[model samples]
Target: MTNVLVLGANGKIAKLATAQLLANPDNHLTLFLRNSKRLANAASDRVKVVEGDAASEADLKAVMADADIVYANLAGSIEAEAKAVVAAMDASGLKRLIWISTLGIYDEVPGNFGKWNHQMLDGGYLETYGAAAKTIEDSDLDYTIIRPAWLSNNDEVAYETTQKGEAFKGTEVSRKSIAALVAKLVADPSQAIHESLGVNKPNTDGDKPAWY
Candidate 1:
Protein backbone atom coordinates (compact mmCIF):
# COMPACT_ATOMS: atom_id res chain seq x y z
CA MET A 1 0.00 0.00 0.00
CA THR A 2 1.11 3.55 -0.73
CA ASN A 3 0.90 5.74 2.33
CA VAL A 4 0.50 9.37 1.27
CA LEU A 5 0.73 12.43 3.48
CA VAL A 6 -1.11 15.39 2.06
CA LEU A 7 -0.12 18.73 3.52
CA GLY A 8 -2.56 21.59 3.16
CA ALA A 9 -5.37 19.12 2.79
CA ASN A 10 -7.94 21.89 2.90
CA GLY A 11 -6.68 23.41 -0.34
CA LYS A 12 -8.98 23.20 -3.36
CA ILE A 13 -6.57 21.18 -5.49
CA ALA A 14 -5.58 18.99 -2.54
CA LYS A 15 -9.22 18.13 -1.92
CA LEU A 16 -9.65 17.18 -5.57
CA ALA A 17 -6.47 15.15 -5.47
CA THR A 18 -7.69 13.41 -2.32
CA ALA A 19 -10.68 12.02 -4.21
CA GLN A 20 -8.46 10.83 -7.01
CA LEU A 21 -5.97 9.24 -4.62
CA LEU A 22 -8.72 7.46 -2.71
CA ALA A 23 -10.00 5.95 -5.96
CA ASN A 24 -6.97 3.67 -5.88
CA PRO A 25 -7.73 1.14 -3.19
CA ASP A 26 -4.05 0.63 -2.46
CA ASN A 27 -3.53 4.24 -1.57
CA HIS A 28 -4.03 5.41 2.01
CA LEU A 29 -4.00 9.09 2.90
CA THR A 30 -3.18 11.16 6.00
CA LEU A 31 -4.64 14.60 5.50
CA PHE A 32 -2.69 17.29 7.34
CA LEU A 33 -3.80 20.86 7.77
CA ARG A 34 -3.77 23.68 10.28
CA ASN A 35 -7.39 23.06 11.21
CA SER A 36 -8.39 19.43 11.63
CA LYS A 37 -12.02 20.41 12.11
CA ARG A 38 -12.16 21.58 8.51
CA LEU A 39 -11.72 17.98 7.32
CA ALA A 40 -13.43 16.25 10.26
CA ASN A 41 -16.00 14.72 7.95
CA ALA A 42 -13.41 13.31 5.53
CA ALA A 43 -11.86 10.84 7.95
CA SER A 44 -12.29 7.15 7.27
CA ASP A 45 -10.50 3.83 7.59
CA ARG A 46 -8.26 4.78 4.67
CA VAL A 47 -8.12 8.44 5.51
CA LYS A 48 -6.65 10.10 8.62
CA VAL A 49 -7.27 13.80 9.16
CA VAL A 50 -4.80 15.58 11.43
CA GLU A 51 -4.34 19.20 12.35
CA GLY A 52 -0.85 20.74 12.32
CA ASP A 53 1.11 23.63 10.92
CA ALA A 54 3.37 22.87 7.98
CA ALA A 55 5.85 25.37 9.34
CA SER A 56 6.52 23.16 12.33
CA GLU A 57 9.10 20.46 11.71
CA ALA A 58 8.00 18.60 14.84
CA ASP A 59 4.43 18.49 13.60
CA LEU A 60 5.52 17.32 10.17
CA LYS A 61 7.79 14.61 11.58
CA ALA A 62 4.91 13.23 13.63
CA VAL A 63 2.88 12.63 10.46
CA MET A 64 5.89 11.55 8.41
CA ALA A 65 6.20 8.31 10.37
CA ASP A 66 4.19 6.19 7.95
CA ALA A 67 4.18 8.36 4.83
CA ASP A 68 5.91 7.05 1.76
CA ILE A 69 5.25 10.18 -0.23
CA VAL A 70 4.72 13.81 0.75
CA TYR A 71 2.57 16.10 -1.37
CA ALA A 72 2.66 19.71 -0.27
CA ASN A 73 0.07 22.22 -1.49
CA LEU A 74 0.66 25.26 0.63
CA ALA A 75 0.36 29.05 0.60
CA GLY A 76 1.59 31.94 2.77
CA SER A 77 5.10 32.04 4.23
CA ILE A 78 5.87 29.26 1.82
CA GLU A 79 9.64 29.43 2.12
CA ALA A 80 9.57 28.79 5.85
CA GLU A 81 7.10 25.98 5.36
CA ALA A 82 9.29 24.47 2.69
CA LYS A 83 12.27 24.57 4.99
CA ALA A 84 10.29 22.93 7.73
CA VAL A 85 9.09 20.20 5.38
CA VAL A 86 12.55 19.46 4.09
CA ALA A 87 14.04 19.35 7.58
CA ALA A 88 11.26 17.16 8.90
CA MET A 89 11.46 14.78 5.98
CA ASP A 90 15.20 14.50 6.39
CA ALA A 91 14.82 13.86 10.07
CA SER A 92 12.25 11.16 9.44
CA GLY A 93 14.43 9.57 6.72
CA LEU A 94 11.71 10.17 4.14
CA LYS A 95 12.28 11.14 0.54
CA ARG A 96 9.91 11.44 -2.45
CA LEU A 97 8.16 14.82 -2.41
CA ILE A 98 5.67 16.46 -4.72
CA TRP A 99 5.53 20.22 -4.38
CA ILE A 100 2.90 22.52 -5.87
CA SER A 101 4.39 25.78 -7.05
CA THR A 102 3.26 28.53 -9.40
CA LEU A 103 4.26 29.51 -12.94
CA GLY A 104 6.86 32.23 -13.80
CA ILE A 105 9.16 31.12 -10.97
CA TYR A 106 11.89 30.59 -13.56
CA ASP A 107 11.06 33.61 -15.70
CA GLU A 108 10.63 31.11 -18.55
CA VAL A 109 7.32 32.37 -19.88
CA PRO A 110 7.84 34.11 -23.24
CA GLY A 111 6.47 37.17 -25.01
CA ASN A 112 3.85 39.57 -23.67
CA PHE A 113 2.47 36.81 -21.50
CA GLY A 114 5.76 36.63 -19.65
CA LYS A 115 5.72 40.35 -19.11
CA TRP A 116 2.14 40.25 -17.98
CA ASN A 117 2.86 37.38 -15.64
CA HIS A 118 5.54 39.40 -13.91
CA GLN A 119 3.14 42.30 -13.56
CA MET A 120 0.72 40.00 -11.82
CA LEU A 121 3.05 37.93 -9.62
CA ASP A 122 5.94 40.24 -8.85
CA GLY A 123 6.72 41.74 -5.44
CA GLY A 124 6.54 38.84 -2.91
CA TYR A 125 4.68 35.86 -4.27
CA LEU A 126 7.14 34.72 -6.92
CA GLU A 127 10.17 35.38 -4.76
CA THR A 128 9.07 33.28 -1.80
CA TYR A 129 7.77 30.51 -4.04
CA GLY A 130 11.02 30.43 -5.95
CA ALA A 131 12.90 30.17 -2.70
CA ALA A 132 10.68 27.27 -1.69
CA ALA A 133 11.33 25.43 -4.94
CA LYS A 134 15.02 25.99 -4.47
CA THR A 135 14.86 24.45 -1.02
CA ILE A 136 13.23 21.33 -2.42
CA GLU A 137 15.63 21.08 -5.34
CA ASP A 138 18.65 21.50 -3.12
CA SER A 139 17.56 18.70 -0.85
CA ASP A 140 18.76 15.12 -1.26
CA LEU A 141 15.20 13.87 -1.49
CA ASP A 142 13.69 12.75 -4.79
CA TYR A 143 11.27 15.53 -5.60
CA THR A 144 8.97 16.76 -8.38
CA ILE A 145 7.97 20.37 -8.41
CA ILE A 146 4.72 21.19 -10.21
CA ARG A 147 4.43 24.72 -11.51
CA PRO A 148 0.91 25.47 -12.66
CA ALA A 149 -0.12 28.36 -14.85
CA TRP A 150 -2.94 30.75 -14.01
CA LEU A 151 -5.59 28.57 -12.37
CA SER A 152 -9.25 28.28 -13.25
CA ASN A 153 -12.08 26.41 -11.55
CA ASN A 154 -13.04 24.57 -14.76
CA ASP A 155 -14.14 20.98 -14.34
CA GLU A 156 -12.09 19.71 -17.28
CA VAL A 157 -8.79 17.92 -16.73
CA ALA A 158 -7.06 18.56 -20.06
CA TYR A 159 -3.53 19.84 -19.63
CA GLU A 160 0.11 19.62 -20.81
CA THR A 161 3.52 20.10 -19.25
CA THR A 162 6.77 21.95 -19.89
CA GLN A 163 10.06 21.06 -18.21
CA LYS A 164 12.22 23.45 -16.31
CA GLY A 165 14.15 25.86 -18.61
CA GLU A 166 11.51 25.41 -21.33
CA ALA A 167 9.26 28.35 -21.95
CA PHE A 168 6.01 27.80 -20.07
CA LYS A 169 3.05 27.18 -22.37
CA GLY A 170 -0.52 28.49 -22.49
CA THR A 171 -1.99 31.05 -20.12
CA GLU A 172 -4.22 29.03 -17.87
CA VAL A 173 -5.19 25.53 -16.71
CA SER A 174 -7.89 23.96 -14.59
CA ARG A 175 -7.32 23.12 -10.94
CA LYS A 176 -8.71 19.68 -11.73
CA SER A 177 -5.93 19.14 -14.23
CA ILE A 178 -3.32 19.81 -11.56
CA ALA A 179 -5.08 17.39 -9.23
CA ALA A 180 -5.11 14.73 -11.94
CA LEU A 181 -1.41 15.20 -12.49
CA VAL A 182 -0.75 14.86 -8.77
CA ALA A 183 -2.66 11.58 -8.69
CA LYS A 184 -0.73 10.32 -11.71
CA LEU A 185 2.53 11.02 -9.94
CA VAL A 186 1.40 9.26 -6.80
CA ALA A 187 0.55 6.19 -8.83
CA ASP A 188 4.02 6.13 -10.38
CA PRO A 189 6.45 7.48 -7.85
CA SER A 190 9.48 7.05 -10.10
CA GLN A 191 8.18 9.41 -12.74
CA ALA A 192 9.34 13.03 -12.90
CA ILE A 193 11.83 12.71 -10.07
CA HIS A 194 13.96 15.83 -9.63
CA GLU A 195 11.99 17.50 -12.42
CA SER A 196 10.04 20.72 -12.33
CA LEU A 197 6.97 20.67 -14.55
CA GLY A 198 5.03 23.67 -15.83
CA VAL A 199 1.41 22.66 -16.38
CA ASN A 200 -1.09 24.42 -18.65
CA LYS A 201 -4.05 23.86 -20.93
CA PRO A 202 -3.06 23.36 -24.56
CA ASN A 203 -3.66 26.21 -27.01
CA THR A 204 -4.83 28.62 -24.36
CA ASP A 205 -1.83 30.88 -24.84
CA GLY A 206 -2.62 34.55 -24.43
CA ASP A 207 -1.17 37.68 -22.89
CA LYS A 208 -3.34 36.92 -19.91
CA PRO A 209 -5.84 34.31 -18.80
CA ALA A 210 -9.17 34.51 -20.65
CA TRP A 211 -11.01 35.64 -17.56
CA TYR A 212 -8.58 38.44 -16.86
Candidate 2:
Protein backbone atom coordinates (compact mmCIF):
# COMPACT_ATOMS: atom_id res chain seq x y z
CA MET A 1 0.00 0.00 0.00
CA THR A 2 1.21 3.51 -0.81
CA ASN A 3 0.89 5.91 2.09
CA VAL A 4 0.64 9.50 0.81
CA LEU A 5 0.89 12.52 3.09
CA VAL A 6 -0.69 15.69 1.74
CA LEU A 7 0.35 19.00 3.27
CA GLY A 8 -1.96 22.00 2.78
CA ALA A 9 -4.80 19.57 2.27
CA ASN A 10 -7.39 22.33 2.14
CA GLY A 11 -6.02 23.75 -1.12
CA LYS A 12 -8.17 23.24 -4.21
CA ILE A 13 -5.73 21.10 -6.17
CA ALA A 14 -4.85 19.06 -3.09
CA LYS A 15 -8.52 18.27 -2.49
CA LEU A 16 -8.93 17.13 -6.10
CA ALA A 17 -5.76 15.04 -5.92
CA THR A 18 -6.97 13.51 -2.65
CA ALA A 19 -10.14 12.23 -4.30
CA GLN A 20 -8.20 10.82 -7.23
CA LEU A 21 -5.66 9.14 -4.98
CA LEU A 22 -8.45 7.59 -2.89
CA ALA A 23 -9.98 6.06 -6.03
CA ASN A 24 -7.20 3.49 -5.95
CA PRO A 25 -8.02 1.14 -3.10
CA ASP A 26 -4.39 0.44 -2.27
CA ASN A 27 -3.48 4.08 -1.61
CA HIS A 28 -3.90 5.50 1.89
CA LEU A 29 -3.76 9.22 2.68
CA THR A 30 -2.82 11.43 5.62
CA LEU A 31 -4.27 14.90 5.15
CA PHE A 32 -2.10 17.40 7.07
CA LEU A 33 -3.16 20.97 7.49
CA ARG A 34 -3.14 23.72 10.11
CA ASN A 35 -6.65 22.98 11.27
CA SER A 36 -7.88 19.41 11.14
CA LYS A 37 -11.41 20.67 11.55
CA ARG A 38 -11.39 21.90 7.97
CA LEU A 39 -11.15 18.28 6.87
CA ALA A 40 -13.12 16.81 9.77
CA ASN A 41 -15.43 15.04 7.34
CA ALA A 42 -12.57 13.55 5.29
CA ALA A 43 -11.39 10.90 7.73
CA SER A 44 -11.93 7.18 7.12
CA ASP A 45 -10.19 3.85 7.61
CA ARG A 46 -7.79 4.70 4.80
CA VAL A 47 -7.65 8.42 5.43
CA LYS A 48 -6.12 10.16 8.44
CA VAL A 49 -6.51 13.90 8.93
CA VAL A 50 -4.02 15.69 11.18
CA GLU A 51 -3.58 19.29 12.23
CA GLY A 52 -0.03 20.73 11.94
CA ASP A 53 2.04 23.63 10.71
CA ALA A 54 4.07 22.95 7.58
CA ALA A 55 6.91 25.17 8.78
CA SER A 56 7.35 23.19 11.97
CA GLU A 57 9.82 20.35 11.47
CA ALA A 58 8.53 18.55 14.57
CA ASP A 59 4.98 18.73 13.28
CA LEU A 60 6.05 17.40 9.92
CA LYS A 61 8.20 14.65 11.44
CA ALA A 62 5.36 13.45 13.63
CA VAL A 63 3.32 12.57 10.52
CA MET A 64 6.20 11.32 8.33
CA ALA A 65 6.67 7.97 9.99
CA ASP A 66 4.33 6.04 7.68
CA ALA A 67 4.32 8.26 4.64
CA ASP A 68 5.74 6.89 1.40
CA ILE A 69 5.25 10.12 -0.46
CA VAL A 70 4.88 13.76 0.51
CA TYR A 71 2.83 16.15 -1.61
CA ALA A 72 3.13 19.74 -0.42
CA ASN A 73 0.66 22.33 -1.74
CA LEU A 74 1.56 25.43 0.20
CA ALA A 75 1.83 29.23 0.07
CA GLY A 76 3.29 31.97 2.27
CA SER A 77 6.60 31.47 4.06
CA ILE A 78 7.16 28.76 1.49
CA GLU A 79 10.95 28.79 1.82
CA ALA A 80 10.73 28.01 5.52
CA GLU A 81 8.23 25.26 4.79
CA ALA A 82 10.51 23.81 2.12
CA LYS A 83 13.43 23.64 4.53
CA ALA A 84 11.26 22.06 7.19
CA VAL A 85 9.89 19.47 4.76
CA VAL A 86 13.35 18.50 3.52
CA ALA A 87 14.64 18.16 7.07
CA ALA A 88 11.67 16.06 8.14
CA MET A 89 11.92 13.83 5.08
CA ASP A 90 15.63 13.36 5.62
CA ALA A 91 15.04 12.43 9.24
CA SER A 92 12.28 10.02 8.30
CA GLY A 93 14.29 8.44 5.47
CA LEU A 94 11.45 9.20 3.07
CA LYS A 95 12.50 10.17 -0.46
CA ARG A 96 9.58 10.99 -2.72
CA LEU A 97 8.16 14.51 -2.81
CA ILE A 98 5.81 16.40 -5.10
CA TRP A 99 5.97 20.18 -4.74
CA ILE A 100 3.47 22.58 -6.35
CA SER A 101 5.21 25.75 -7.53
CA THR A 102 4.43 28.44 -10.10
CA LEU A 103 5.78 29.21 -13.57
CA GLY A 104 8.68 31.70 -14.17
CA ILE A 105 10.56 30.80 -11.01
CA TYR A 106 13.50 30.15 -13.33
CA ASP A 107 12.76 33.17 -15.49
CA GLU A 108 12.26 30.69 -18.31
CA VAL A 109 8.99 32.07 -19.60
CA PRO A 110 9.71 33.58 -23.08
CA GLY A 111 8.62 36.52 -25.26
CA ASN A 112 6.15 39.21 -24.28
CA PHE A 113 4.50 36.79 -21.93
CA GLY A 114 7.75 36.38 -20.04
CA LYS A 115 8.00 40.12 -19.60
CA TRP A 116 4.42 40.28 -18.48
CA ASN A 117 4.94 37.40 -16.10
CA HIS A 118 7.93 39.13 -14.50
CA GLN A 119 6.01 42.39 -14.32
CA MET A 120 3.21 40.62 -12.52
CA LEU A 121 5.22 38.35 -10.24
CA ASP A 122 8.53 40.15 -9.56
CA GLY A 123 7.76 42.29 -6.52
CA GLY A 124 7.84 39.63 -3.80
CA TYR A 125 5.86 36.59 -4.92
CA LEU A 126 8.41 35.21 -7.37
CA GLU A 127 11.37 35.91 -5.10
CA THR A 128 10.04 33.90 -2.16
CA TYR A 129 8.77 31.13 -4.40
CA GLY A 130 12.10 30.97 -6.20
CA ALA A 131 13.89 30.65 -2.88
CA ALA A 132 11.52 27.88 -1.88
CA ALA A 133 12.10 26.00 -5.13
CA LYS A 134 15.83 26.42 -4.62
CA THR A 135 15.52 24.93 -1.16
CA ILE A 136 13.83 21.84 -2.58
CA GLU A 137 16.29 21.55 -5.46
CA ASP A 138 19.23 21.72 -3.11
CA SER A 139 17.87 18.95 -0.89
CA ASP A 140 18.91 15.32 -1.10
CA LEU A 141 15.32 14.11 -1.33
CA ASP A 142 13.92 12.92 -4.66
CA TYR A 143 11.49 15.65 -5.68
CA THR A 144 9.40 16.83 -8.61
CA ILE A 145 8.63 20.53 -8.64
CA ILE A 146 5.49 21.35 -10.61
CA ARG A 147 5.48 24.83 -12.09
CA PRO A 148 1.97 25.52 -13.33
CA ALA A 149 1.01 28.30 -15.70
CA TRP A 150 -1.67 30.86 -14.93
CA LEU A 151 -4.44 28.88 -13.27
CA SER A 152 -8.14 28.74 -14.03
CA ASN A 153 -11.23 27.06 -12.62
CA ASN A 154 -11.92 25.45 -16.00
CA ASP A 155 -13.33 21.94 -15.73
CA GLU A 156 -10.85 20.32 -18.09
CA VAL A 157 -7.63 18.33 -17.88
CA ALA A 158 -5.83 19.31 -21.09
CA TYR A 159 -2.20 20.20 -20.40
CA GLU A 160 1.41 19.64 -21.38
CA THR A 161 4.81 20.11 -19.71
CA THR A 162 8.20 21.76 -20.32
CA GLN A 163 11.50 20.89 -18.68
CA LYS A 164 13.34 23.23 -16.30
CA GLY A 165 15.56 24.95 -18.88
CA GLU A 166 13.00 24.93 -21.66
CA ALA A 167 10.84 27.97 -22.24
CA PHE A 168 7.49 27.55 -20.51
CA LYS A 169 4.67 26.75 -22.89
CA GLY A 170 1.12 28.09 -23.33
CA THR A 171 -0.50 30.62 -21.02
CA GLU A 172 -2.83 28.90 -18.65
CA VAL A 173 -3.89 25.49 -17.37
CA SER A 174 -6.81 24.33 -15.26
CA ARG A 175 -6.38 23.38 -11.61
CA LYS A 176 -7.91 20.02 -12.53
CA SER A 177 -5.03 19.36 -14.89
CA ILE A 178 -2.52 20.04 -12.12
CA ALA A 179 -4.50 17.71 -9.84
CA ALA A 180 -4.49 15.04 -12.52
CA LEU A 181 -0.72 15.41 -12.87
CA VAL A 182 -0.30 15.02 -9.12
CA ALA A 183 -2.43 11.86 -9.12
CA LYS A 184 -0.42 10.49 -12.03
CA LEU A 185 2.82 11.06 -10.13
CA VAL A 186 1.42 9.35 -7.04
CA ALA A 187 0.33 6.38 -9.13
CA ASP A 188 3.79 6.08 -10.69
CA PRO A 189 6.46 7.68 -8.52
CA SER A 190 9.26 6.84 -10.92
CA GLN A 191 8.28 9.49 -13.42
CA ALA A 192 9.79 13.01 -13.23
CA ILE A 193 12.02 12.25 -10.27
CA HIS A 194 14.41 15.16 -9.65
CA GLU A 195 12.70 17.17 -12.42
CA SER A 196 10.94 20.50 -12.50
CA LEU A 197 7.97 20.53 -14.86
CA GLY A 198 6.23 23.56 -16.33
CA VAL A 199 2.60 22.66 -16.95
CA ASN A 200 0.27 24.48 -19.37
CA LYS A 201 -2.60 23.80 -21.72
CA PRO A 202 -1.50 23.06 -25.27
CA ASN A 203 -2.36 25.64 -27.98
CA THR A 204 -3.12 28.30 -25.38
CA ASP A 205 0.12 30.24 -25.76
CA GLY A 206 -0.24 34.00 -25.61
CA ASP A 207 0.95 37.13 -23.86
CA LYS A 208 -1.67 36.49 -21.23
CA PRO A 209 -4.29 33.92 -20.34
CA ALA A 210 -7.41 33.94 -22.51
CA TRP A 211 -9.56 35.32 -19.72
CA TYR A 212 -7.22 38.23 -19.07
Using lDDT, give the best candidate's number: 1
lDDT per model vs. reference: 0.97, 0.96
Q: Could you tell me every candidate's TM-score relative to the true structure?
A: 0.99, 0.99
Q: Which stretches of candidate 1 lie over 4 Å from their true place?
A: none
lDDT of 2 by residue, 1-212 (tens): 99999999999999988999999999999999999999999999999999999999999999999999999999888999999999999999999999999999999999999999999999999999999999999999899999999999999999999999999999999999999999999999999999999999999989999988
Among these predictions, the greatest TM-score belongs to 1
For residue 126, model 1's alpha carbon misses the true position, in angstroms, by 0.3
Candidate 2 deviant stretches above 4 angstroms:
none
Score candidate 2 by TM-score against the native: 0.99
Each prediction's Cα RMSD?
0.5, 0.7
